[model samples]
Target: MRIPVLAAVLATAASLCSAVPANAAAVWEPCDPAPLQCTSVAVPLDHARPHGAQVSLRVSRLPAGRPADRRGTLVLIPSGPGNTGVARPVTLNLPPEVRDVYDVVSFDPRGLGGSTLASCELSLADLGGLNPWPAPDGGISANVATARRVAAACAGNGGDLVRSISSRTEVDDLDRIRAALGERRISYWGISYGAYVGAAYATRYPGRTDRVVLDSLGDPDPDRLARGWLANTAVGAEDRFADFARWAVAQGMAPDAAAARELFLSAAARLDRSPREWVTGNTLREALRGLNTDAGLPRLGQLVRVASGGPLPAPPQPPPAAALQNLAAVATATICNDVAWPRPVEDYRRGVADNRARYPLTAGMPANITPCAFWPYPPHQPIRITDRGPSNVLLVQNLRDQATPYAGALRMREALGRRAVLVSVDAGGHGSYRSSGNACGDAAVTRYLLTGTRPATDVLCR
Candidate 1:
């Protein structure tokens, strides 16, 4: 059973100081690919037993361009619980002025990238079920079977490291990084799921945080955790699909937005009934969710055109087997270990059926059962985000984000209370700051980071 929000908050507050060990300063060395310095920080595999087995987290840094103006470290938290941040310092398109004042840092969370690795060694078929996309007809029986099998695989082969992965673990590791960097407090910029990490860090180590930005937030409710984030993709998909439809009509893919919607739905339905060798209904749905941005419009339009009986595109290359296994293991363990999923298969069946009728674009996939259902480990105490933190957080969210929709972001804002000010950008995409190209939203966040002044109240950027 899940803990209530207030109790979770109290539990988190009680353990804040004792959660991790004293941070040892990181020994940095020049790594390959100039300008990116790298190091590793060893954190306990389990925080409860700090002296037990250890896991090394790979850390990287791109020093401030103008050291004379350097304010302090600004950590860039990775997006996926599965995504790595070790290269973000070099890869992220950060604004020059911000880069001039802060030494940017990032890391591969445990079970990812260069950190200690763990794998369920899931087969290709089991790996495909990680996202829990429902069958074409909105049935979840196959999803349930895959969930059980994947869960068993992880329990049998993932060992202690995989079982240890969770958002709380990531937060603990981040605090250790702060100590290793020898900074009294650190600024942060976290996108998508990373935003949750930033919020948790701020809550747990409020005094140790400065100028913080949470872009593309997921719901911060402790009771639901990642389960809520997953189910919410149904709503997110619909909100973003409208934008895609409008773009499709503008690009002559259909007569109007309504026709474009029909075109996509019809194509997806036909594919559901008779899937191509590489493309299926779920493939189209996933593509629609991924391609909801302006930069992705052209490809999304082309995909819809082809799916409407035009020539088929070549299949994309598969990811490396090792990488796939690592991602599946980490993502699965993180979500499942964060909170207990409902056990009854009927719970998912009802959810999938309801979502399929209301949100056809997703075909109930977002609500389908996952390996979390059969996960062997019980969850750590969920983090409860509250207004106890400093008023140092600035949240920037797009109006229509497919992955972490605006509606859910409101929950994050509500959870943080007066501790955060929100910048709502009238855009249609997953990320809002630089990724959305919204000068208004970018200006708000940049201003906060550089000057520590958020809007006097919540503001909308049109």
Candidate 2:
């Protein structure tokens, strides 16, 4: 999710290998031909009933370059509730300072990749056709039926993997991984949904955490959870779009910021009515949501320009059904398990209409019905991030994050109380650490993780 500068600490660090028990052997073998060492740790399906049943989690580790100076294992919690973490070592480009002092570790959660299989078996066509954005007129009758069908598919096919998946279970799995590695305490670098998991772990086992970095945090509302995250997408998009508009204006896409917004809105509305080309209203909204920085502004502007009233492109090919089925299976399980969503058809209709009116940029996706509405089971109580933990947390957030906005992060910041020191970067994008390219923000995170030097109060990195 987010990175560097402690040669002195590396040279003076004590070997933590002695803390591990001789009998607690974690046999880590290279994952294929990659540099990552892979292993599996067994944990109970349900933490409440530890003696009932068990499941094995696939864990991967990027060993510290200087094993003699390795202080502890640094766990990288992947972004999605559905995203695979075992492949994280390949994607994660850590600074030498961080890689030298800590063995980077990550794992796939219960229902994702190598660990376990849970397929919803949804039709490829249905998955592609199912847009969270309802009809332009805000009619949700078809959307409601689609939501019901998807949920039914998941209920029938997801099986025990869906039933056992929850934030609580995952956190417990993380602790088990720590024990398996023979580390008394572990450090964390969690982004987006991963940040929520990290907060849950820190609150539950504050004493067992050495240093925690909650990057691009989500709202930790006890009742809302992912729902809150979904709902905030509209606000985040609007905030981020302003930055994009400025970039577009500079790139000569529009005369002004207002013109850029107007062009995008009008073009999106036109596509909603008569969609002749490959680009549709949903496509535009998704592009807006996904454009995390200025680098994406020109392409987004071009897409909007061509889709407004220009020539059509070739018809796009539909993705394979198996892939969507896997993603839906895990994502639905996670969202449905984290919290309960509104169940009635009217609730969705009203939400879509209201959201569409209030935030035209996001259309109605944020408030529209998901598989959670028809989930067979109720959610386990969502965990609340509290000040009951150690003050070992460092939060690095961008002011205008599309996925996790500054406002939502403020709630997490407030919830953590004195346990965290926030490094607020004056930027407009998502994931504020190394990826932001803001030296001030990156340096703060690297310094905290490497040297354990955090500001006594929150610092604004501009």
- Overall local distance difference test of candidate 2: 0.80
Clashes of each: 0, 0
Q: Lowest summed-lDDT stretch of 10 residues in model 2?
A: 1-10
**Per-residue alpha-carbon lDDT of candidate 1 for residues 1-462, written as tens digits (9 for 90 to 100):** 433322332343344342223476666788755689888777777888887656677888999999999999999999987888888988888999999999999998887777766678788888866777887767788888999999998887777777788999999989888988999999999999999999999999999999999999999889888989988888888888888888787777789878888989988888888777777777788887885468887766656666657667777776887878778888888899999889889998998899889888888887888888888789988899999967889999998899999889999999999999999999998878888888988999999889998999999999
Q: What does candidate 2's lDDT look like per residue over 1-462, in tens digits?
A: 000012211221222232222226688888943888888766666778765555666788899989999888899997877777997866776788899989999998866665655576677655765557787787777777777888887777666656778887788888988998888999989988899999999999999999899999889998999889999998899889888788778878789989989888987888787775578777778888887766777667766876656655454465455555556777778888888888887888888888988998988888998778888888987788899977899999998888898999999999999999999998888787878888998998999999999987898988
The deviation in Å at residue 444 for candidate 1 is: 1.1
lDDT of 1: 0.84
Off by over 4 Å in 2: 1-24, 129-131, 309-321
TM-score of model number 1: 0.94
lDDT of each: 0.84, 0.80
Q: Which residue runs of candidate 1 sit more than 4 Å off their true CA positions?
A: 1-22
